[model samples]
Target: MKILQDFELLFQQELHKLYDNDEIKAIFLVVIAEKLGLNTANYQLSKKDPVDDKNSAEILSILRDLKKHKPIQYILNKADFYGEVFQVNESVLIPRQETEELVDLIIKNHKFSQNLNIIDIGTGSGCIPITLSKHLTNARVTTIDISKEAIKTAQENANILKTAVQFINADIFEWEYIFSNQHYHIIVSNPPYITPGEKKYMNENVLAYEPELALFIEESTPLIFYDVISSFALKHLAPDGDLYFEINQYLGAEMKDLMIKKGFEQVKLIKDINGADRIIHAKKAW
Candidate 1:
């Protein structure tokens, strides 16, 4: 393919062939410009000249990566979630809009306390834990992830954002420590809830590029993470403490039912911007 003379025209034409979403395409173009050391804000501010030869070569390379179904966020090595930017790569699942809804629900409903303890399980990129730490000034956040690479990335993000989030590299399934007298006021997770049957439906960008350990659960035990996290909450959550999750839309009712069966009070399934059942919020019985 011939490299077009104009950057904007070239971006629009190249991305149109790959992504169906115009907004995503526009965002990708900005990412491409940013990667090329071009001031994206200035590029937008001024109808700038065409990208120079060096940048044109860079754009061509990025376009090829995008064509291979790599997510633009991964291409840019960053994504914005919950009013904060997080560095992301193939090691972790990209933060999604639905997870933002889960965070918003927790922030909106819970009353902040100076000594509130918050734990975020499966803290990919530390988006949830860091966001919570940022909003709840008095809260001390702890985040756990099994992947060493993911934990490293999350820790880097916490440092970059100047957020004090304690990160633990541990598998929740094998974690056997007890809090004893210590209790968390909030426990939140956006765990791997996608079932085996659904894996076939995911696009190559997700199935091929994203971490499988952060995306899939066995069909026989689709609620594996939920069950483990809920068990932990039952034992560790403070009386009347809240537990929140970003659930699989297809299993919203099942998640609510599990919480109810576990003796949680005020169990509620919440919808995201797309009106899909995406979040579940419940409080431990006092």
Candidate 2:
């Protein structure tokens, strides 16, 4: 393992125990490229590049953590969302590609206009609002999270992304009381929609490392956030305001019906790249 190329075989062997051969290779390649400051193309060209004793030990240590099911994003403390990098830790859920689809959906459907107000509920990592602020330049964006730590992390990410997103540290359930005057032209959330019963189906890394508060809900009321937020929109959203959600894959029809019952119009459920129901788009038809 003294040579960088020499570690490849051993790393793949270790990762193969937990991941498919393709994924193991992909992960190893990414880690090596990042650690060695080589692009994938260059790394493939320099497979024989040597690793010093210190660097070899560091690589092995990281591999050990990976073997224990630590998420690679947490290992690097960064995730790419919507063509931008967001800082993430265990306090917040790592921004996923599906969530990027959620963001893209909003960006595609809504044209950013002057004074457009947007608020994101449960702003984990602030990825949604921050990205919206970055691209929706004239939109005044604010994001709320129940966890102060998550708010702080979101603030840091906002700063890094050079986006002016107001980070509010209050439970969304209490938002009506705390910021009753606040209303929005757009409201979005990628809230905790996973049911407690579904924990058995989650990945080892997600269950072991990601914050549970940002992941799960009571099995009896898996759509608690959606119910509350969509209802809130009935009173708070401006005329023709849009409401977006990254929903549980299992709840598309339920979400559409919920929004419609709450009086939202044009309620649409969208599938992710995998064709699983993952996003819902609806509007207040004032």
Q: Estimate each model's TM-score.
A: 0.91, 0.96
Model 1 CA lDDT for position 276: 92
For every model in order, what is the number of clashing pairs?
A: 0, 1
- Give lDDT tens digits, candidate 1, residues 1-286: 3333355565667667556667545665566557554465655554555556776687778777877888888988998898788999989889998888788877776645666899999988889999889888689998899999999999899999998999989899888573446589899999999987997777777887999999889989988899989988998998778899999999988898899998899998888999999988898887
Best candidate per TM-score, number? 2
Least accurate 10 contiguous residues by lDDT in model 1: 1-10
**How close is each model in CA RMSD to the real structure?**
2.5, 1.3
Clashing pairs in 2: 4-51
Range of the 10 consecutive residues with the lowest summed lDDT in candidate 2: 106-115
lDDT tens digits by residue: candidate 2, 146-179: 9998999999988887888888898877778866
Provide the lDDT at 121 for model 2: 93
**Cand. 2 Cα-lDDT:** 0.86
